[model samples]
Target: MGATAIVTRFAPSPTGHLHLGHAHSALFAWRRAREAGGRFLLRIEDIDPLRCRPEFTEAILEDLAWLGLDWDGEVRVQSAHLPEYRRALDALAARGLLYPCFCTRADIAREIAAAASAPHGPDGPLYPGTCRRLSAAERAVRLAAGEAHALRLDMAAALALLPAPLSFAEGGTRIACDPAQFGDAVLARKDVPASYHLCVTHDDALQGITLVTRGADLRPATHLHRLLQHLMGWPEPAYAHHPLITDATGRRLAKRDRAATLRDLRAAGRSPAEVRALAGWPD
Candidate 1:
C-alpha cells in the first residue's frame, strides 16, 4: 500500500492501569501512523465517571511515554466534550430514530427469559424491545416523573432512514455491515451522557481521524459505527482491527491480571525496550 496521510488515534479508558495488551494496541496504532508518516493522536475515553479516575488518566500518559509512544496533537478528552455528543444525539432524536429506554438490566433479562429464545448479538442477548413499545402518554408520564432512562437507537427506524447494504473500508476491502444485530444499541445512558458507540464515532469524525486501529474484538462494533456515521453524515475512516495479545494460557490480557501491567513489569526492573518486546513490538 502506498503511504497516505492517515490520522490514527489510541483512545484508552482510564478505568485501570496500562497492561501489556494496552501497550500492544497503543504500539500498533502508533506504528501504523509512524510508518505512513501520519498523525498519531491520543484520546482519553473517560465518559464513565464512576469507573474512570483522573489518576488512571495521568498514569496512561506516563505509561505510554515510558513505552516510547509519542502522539501528535493535544489529547482529545471525551469527558470534556459533552455538548458534541449531545448534539449528535439530538440530531438522531429529531429524526425520530432514537427512543428513551426505561428497562434496567434485570428488566431486560426478565423480558428475554419470558421469550422462547432471545436472539444473541455482539454484546450478548439483544435488548428486548420493551420501551420501544411504550405509548406516548406512558413515555411522557415517565419523563415527567423524572424516571432514569437511556437513549437507544431505534434500530428498525434508523435502518429505515438509511440506504441498504452499508459497508466500510477495512484493509482495502469493503466489508458488508450488519447493524440490526445490535438491536437498539444505547447511544446515551443515564449514568453517562454518551455510550462508547456514540462517543467513538463522533470523536473520530470531529478529530478528522483517517484510520482507526484497535483490537479485533471490537470489529463487530464497526458495523454499528458505520451506520452511525452514515446517519450523522460523517466520513467513514479506514479500520485496522488487530488481534489482541494473549497470555501463555491463551486468555486475552485484562486489567484483573496485575502481573501483566506495565507498572509491575517496570517495577521488576524491565527496561522500556524489554517491555516493548514483551508487548510484541521489538525495536
Candidate 2:
C-alpha cells in the first residue's frame, strides 16, 4: 500500500467468542480497505484484565482468519501500550482537563436518585459532577492517601480549550459535536488504568487510521472522540457508522444474549461463504 493509502481497522474486545455481529463488523472494515488497496489493521482491545482473556484474543484471530479476512501488519494489543495511555492522561491532567473521580457506582446512583431530575446522556444519566467539585487540597490528600479513584475529563474545561467548534466528516458531510453530553466522562477507570475512550482514540491516531468504521450504536461516542482528537492535535478520520445486525426478534445481537457464534455455526457445517452471507456480505 502507498503511504497515503486508506487505513481502516476492526478492533474487538476479547471478552467472548466471535459472534455473527463481530463477523459483520470485521467484514465491513476489511472490504473497505481491501477493495481500496489500503491497509486493514486488527487490534485486540484487551485492556480490561478482569474481563478479557488471552484465549479469547487467540480465538478472535482464528475466527477472522477462518472467515478469510487478512489484515496488514502485526495486530496491535492495547494492554501492551499502557505507557501511551498514561502519557495521554498525564497531558490532560497537567492542563486541568482531567480530575480524579472517587465515586463508586453506588455513590453515583444515590446522588442521581437524590436529584429531582437527573439529566440523561447516551450512556444513561450523566455524572452529577460529584468529584469535579473536590477541593485541590482534598484531592491531594486523597491522592496521598492512595484512595482508589478513576480519572474523569472536566468536560467544560476541555470544551473551553477548543479553538473552535468541533465537527467530524461522516459520509462526506460534517456533523457537529456535542461532547458535553457525556458529562465528566471517565478517561481512566478505577479497575483499569486506561478507559476505552482514551485508548481507542490514541490508537487510531497512532495507527494512522484514515477511516473509522463501526456500528451505529457507537456514533454518540464519536462526538467525544472528536474532542479528544482535537485536544491531542491528532488528525481527524472519516467515519462510517453501519447498521447493526439484529436477530429476528428485532433485538441487536450481543454476546450476553448467547448469539450464534461463528465456531458454533462452523460446527453446524456452515461454510465461509454461507457465514459471510449471514454476516450481510457475500463474496
Candidate 3:
C-alpha cells in the first residue's frame, strides 16, 4: 500500500442480525475502498458482552459475503483487545482527565429530576457530575472497596489540555469540533470495560483507516471522537456519514424494529442482487 492509500472500514455491533441499514453502510464503505483500489476492513464491535453473541457475529460475516462484498484483511474483533482499551483509560487517568462515576441510571435520574436545570445532550440528559465532585480520598476508598463504577472523562480538563481547536475533514471541508457538549463522556464501566467512543477512535488509528462512513445519526459523535484522536495524537480520518435507509413509514431499518434481515430476504427467495438494490446499491 502506498502512503496515500484510502483505507475504510465497516464496523458493526453483533447484538442482532444485519438489516438493510447495516447492508447500506457496509456496501458504502466497501465500494469506497474497492473503487479507490484501497483496503476495506471488517470489525466486530462486541464490547457489550451481555448483548452481543458469537452467533450474531458469525451471521454478520455470512451476510456480508452473501452480499458480494469482500474485505481486505482479517476482521478485527473489539472484545479481543481489552488490554489496549484499558491502557487508554489508564493514560487518561494519569492526566487527571478521567474520574470514577459511581452513579447508576436510577441515581442519575433522581439527581436530574430533583435538579432545577439538567441540560440535554445528543443522547439525552447529560450526566449531572455528581461523582465528578468526589474527593480524592473518597474516590480511593470507594475504588478500594470494589464499588461498581464507570469511568467518565473530565470534559473540561480534557478540553483545557487541548493546545488549539479540533476539527476533522469531511468531503473536502473541515468541520470544527466541540466535545464539551457531551459532558464528561463515559470511557469505561463496570459491566463494559470500554465504550464505543473510545474503541472506535482507537481502532481507526490502529488500523490506519483514512475514511469513516456510517449513518448520519452518529455525526454528533464525531465531535467527541475528534477529541479522543487529538488527545491520543492519532491521525484524523475523513468522515462520510450517509443517510440511513428507512422503511415506507420513514422508520430507519434496525434489528430492534424487526426490519427484514438479509437472511430473511434470502429465505424468501430474494436474490442477492435484489437485496443489494433494496439496500440502495443497485450495481
Candidate 4:
C-alpha cells in the first residue's frame, strides 16, 4: 500500500448541528488526503429520514466551508443512492447470503425472554435469530399478508461462503475479521432500504476510496465491513480509526452537547481557527 493514491471521505449524518467531534473526524480525513496529495471527499449519511433534516445538511456544508475544509468532487448523499444499495442487497440475496426477517422488537424480546441464555455482542444482546428459522411456507404467508420485514444477512452462511481467515488493513496492520459476532446483522430495515454497514461499504467501493478515516468508536464495525467487502468483491480500503474528541469531563462530545457545536462557537465570536483548535486541529 506504499504511495498509493489515497482518496478519503468524511461522511456525517445530518441528524443535528455539526459538533466539535464531527470537526475532528472531518479534519482527520481531510489532513490525511492533503498530506498525501490525494483527494478528500464528503458524503452525507442521511439514510434515516426520520432523524435526518435538510436544514442540518445545509448547515454541514456551511460549517465545513467556514472551517476552511474544501473537499473534491460532488458530495455523495446516501439517500440519493438507494438503487445502488438495493442492487448490492440483491447480489447478496442471489448468493443465498440474505434472508427476510419478520421479527419486530417485541417479537425478538419475547423470544429472547423465553430462551435460557441470550448471547451478547458489542452493540447489545445479539438478535436471537428467531426469524431465521422460519419455514418457507411461514415466510411466504407473512410476505403475502404484507407483514413488515427487514433483510438480514445469514452470518453463518456468509462466513461459510468466504474462505477462512478474512482480514483487513488497519493502519498498515492486518487485522483478522469476526463478522459472526454481529449475529445476523440487519442489511436493510423495513423502513429504510439499507443499513449503515451496507451503505458505507457500498459507497466506499463505488467512490474508489483508498483510505477510510473515521473515529475509533467505529473500529468494531470494521470487522463486519471487511466481511461485506469480501462477499461483495469490493476493494478493501486501508482504515484509520482516530481517537474521538471528548469534553472537559472526559465524555465523548455529541449533538446533545450544543455548546460544542460549530454554530454555537461561531455565535460566541470564536474565529474559524479558534474553533479548529478546539476540535484539536490547529493550523
- Candidate that beats the other on lDDT, 1 or 2, i.e. the better one: 2
Error of 4 at 125 (Å): 0.6
Off by over 4 Å in 2: none
Tell how far residue 67 is off in model 1, in angstroms: 0.8
Candidate 3 per-residue lDDT, tens place, 1-283, comes to 6889899999999999998899999999999998898999999999999999999999999999999999987999999999999998899899899999999999999999999999888889999999999999999999999999999999999999889899888988999898988999999977999999999999999999999999999999999999999888889899999999999999888888899888899999999899999999998
RMSD of 1: 1.7
Stretches of candidate 4 exceeding 4 Å from the true structure: 1-3, 257-259
Score each candidate by Cα lDDT.
0.93, 0.96, 0.94, 0.92
Q: Residue 18 of model 4: what lDDT?
A: 91
Instruction: List ranges where model 1 is wrong by over 4 Å.
Output: 1-4
Candidate 2 overall lDDT versus native:
0.96
Model 1: lDDT to the true structure: 0.93
Quote each prediction's TM-score. Answer: 0.97, 0.99, 0.99, 0.97
Count of clashes, each model = 0, 0, 0, 0
- Per-residue lDDT of model 4, residues 1-283, tens digit only: 3557899999999999998999999999999999989999999999999899999999999999999999998999999989989999999999888989988898888888899999977788899888889898998999999999999999999888876788888866898888888999999999988999999999999999999999989999999999999999999999999999988888898886564689989999999999899899988
lDDT of 4: 0.92
What's the TM for model 2?
A: 0.99
How far out, in Å, is residue 241 in model 1? 0.6
lDDT of 1 by residue, 1-283 (tens): 3455888999999999999999999999999989988899999999999999999999999999999999997998999999989998999999989999998999998999999999999989999899999998999999999999999999999898775789989988999999999999999998999999999999999988999999999999999999999999999899999999998899999887663789999999999999999999999
lDDT (Cα, tens digit) per residue for candidate 2, span 1-283: 6888899999999999999999999999999999999999999999999999999999999999999999999999999999999999999899989999999999999999999999999999999999999999999999999999999999999999888899999998999999999989999999998999999999999999999999999999999999999999889999999999999999999999999999999999999999999999988
